[model samples]
Target: MSSFLTNSLKLLSGAIVAVALVTSAPALAAGGHGRKPVDPGFSFEGPFGTFDQGALQRGYKVYREVCSACHSMKLVSFRNLGQKGGPFYDPKYKNPNDNPVVKQIASEFETAEIDPDSGDEVMRKSTPSDRFPSPFKNDEAAKASNGGAIPPDLSVINKARNGHAPYIYSILIGYEPKPVGLEIPDTQHYNAYVAGSLATQWKGDPHHVPAGGVLAMPPPLTDGRVTFDDGTPSTLKQQAKDVTTFLEWAGDPHMVARKQTGFAVILFLILLGGVVYLAYRQTWKGHH
Candidate 1:
């Protein structure tokens, strides 16, 4: 009986050590952490290795002309584009300073008229303080405008949606006609990622390609609606990339600052960890 008890104790100790080794090995291998890698392809590269202002501006143009009809950017204000302080903008795009053409286009919207002190009607250009004007008078009107589907507000879309900017770009470029031998259900939408389904939640019925390949919205840019001033080919992919980048900036103007701050914090933590490790080793020098 005593021999059996001793063997059991030995086995328990070995199990504990094995469990600790298994768990601690991964921790050590990970160097105390794991982090997701940022997608580099989605990044804009210039002399500063940051977002291109020109691209963003052009993207804004595309959004206003094409996407704006279906999407509303409620969170972003016209003033944000002219902000003087933000990671995305060196000098924010604001009223008066806005491009005359862009301002003219935006001014088509009917906004509130403010009375001056003298009681004269003063029609002012829309500001950031104003809420986005709905395209339709009500939900029923909106549904009627967009077939049976409701166009979603794009204000916080970059922040709220999954797949981030890259996903948005991919979705825009991924739209294709249904292929043969695929029966998309009425409910399931077409997605390139999902297999054997049609009618996705975001788009129309799906068929072939992947599951999520079929987007409901027809290709907005089949021909050249927007030509680059630099004479770069205005491909669908380029359009998607530019617009997605703009949306990303709109979503988080401080992303660059936030990344810089995060890197600094990481470096500080690494230095602190090294110091603590050295002190711990010195204090335990007398211990085994």
Candidate 2:
């Protein structure tokens, strides 16, 4: 009887431990790489959805004023910004490359080129065709200035990572001070959405290991970091959402075009299916 009771108690204890682990697993694993991103309810989500031109413009402003300092968007050009699917597109302009706003924005930056007469490097005002300039001459230089961490380029970043648009938005707003008793490495900052791999890049102090890991990027966005020309509220969440939209557009400029094409194709197929069904029914009616 005593042996039976002891065995029963052991089984009960094991069952309790299993239940505890099952219940607490998600709680323990919350807020890391496993963390879920909040949906921004972006304008360009479903099959029929389209990008909001105003939001895109606001997002571009956020990137220009804040993210552009550290992140290079090498693939996007001033010309692309005024092209058909982009936010800045003007129906009145014969050629997007000749857009005055695009030209003005490009002219703000200096591009390096060989001077025809001197046969030497010269800095020249950019044209609409010119790509956005890199903040640093090279990766090593960027790393040296930013505490031994290389800032990733923003171009195609939305496509390169999982969670698509929300991931970028989440990382932008995920910054927080280190939790009590949690050791964060010097020169590193806390961000829940930051991938562990990005933290490993900052090999600053080997001894000053972060409790989980750290992001080399300091909190890049805050309330009112970039004031919108349209007077949208410059909250942290709003900034993050706006910048994410801009990056999404940059990664896939043809997204709207592609969506339109897909929709057209589906509609054509449906109509053809209906016509074919009618023809089949008529032909069979006479035979019957």
List runs of model 1 lying over 4 Å from the truth: 1-40, 44-49, 84-88, 91-110, 113-124, 128-133, 181-196, 199-210
Winning candidate number (lDDT)? 2
Best by TM-score: 2
What ranges in model 2 sit over 4 Å off? 1-32, 197-213, 278-288
Q: What local distance difference test score does each model get? A: 0.61, 0.83
In candidate 2 the C-alpha lDDT for residue 24 amounts to 93
Q: Report lDDT (Cα) of residue 69, candidate 2.
A: 93
Clashes of each: 25, 0
Model 1 Cα shift for residue 50 (angstroms): 3.7
Q: Model 1: per-residue lDDT, tens digit, 165-237?
A: 6566656665555545556554334435322233343242332223454444566654467776667678777
Q: TM-score of every model? A: 0.65, 0.80
List clashing residue pairs in candidate 2.
none
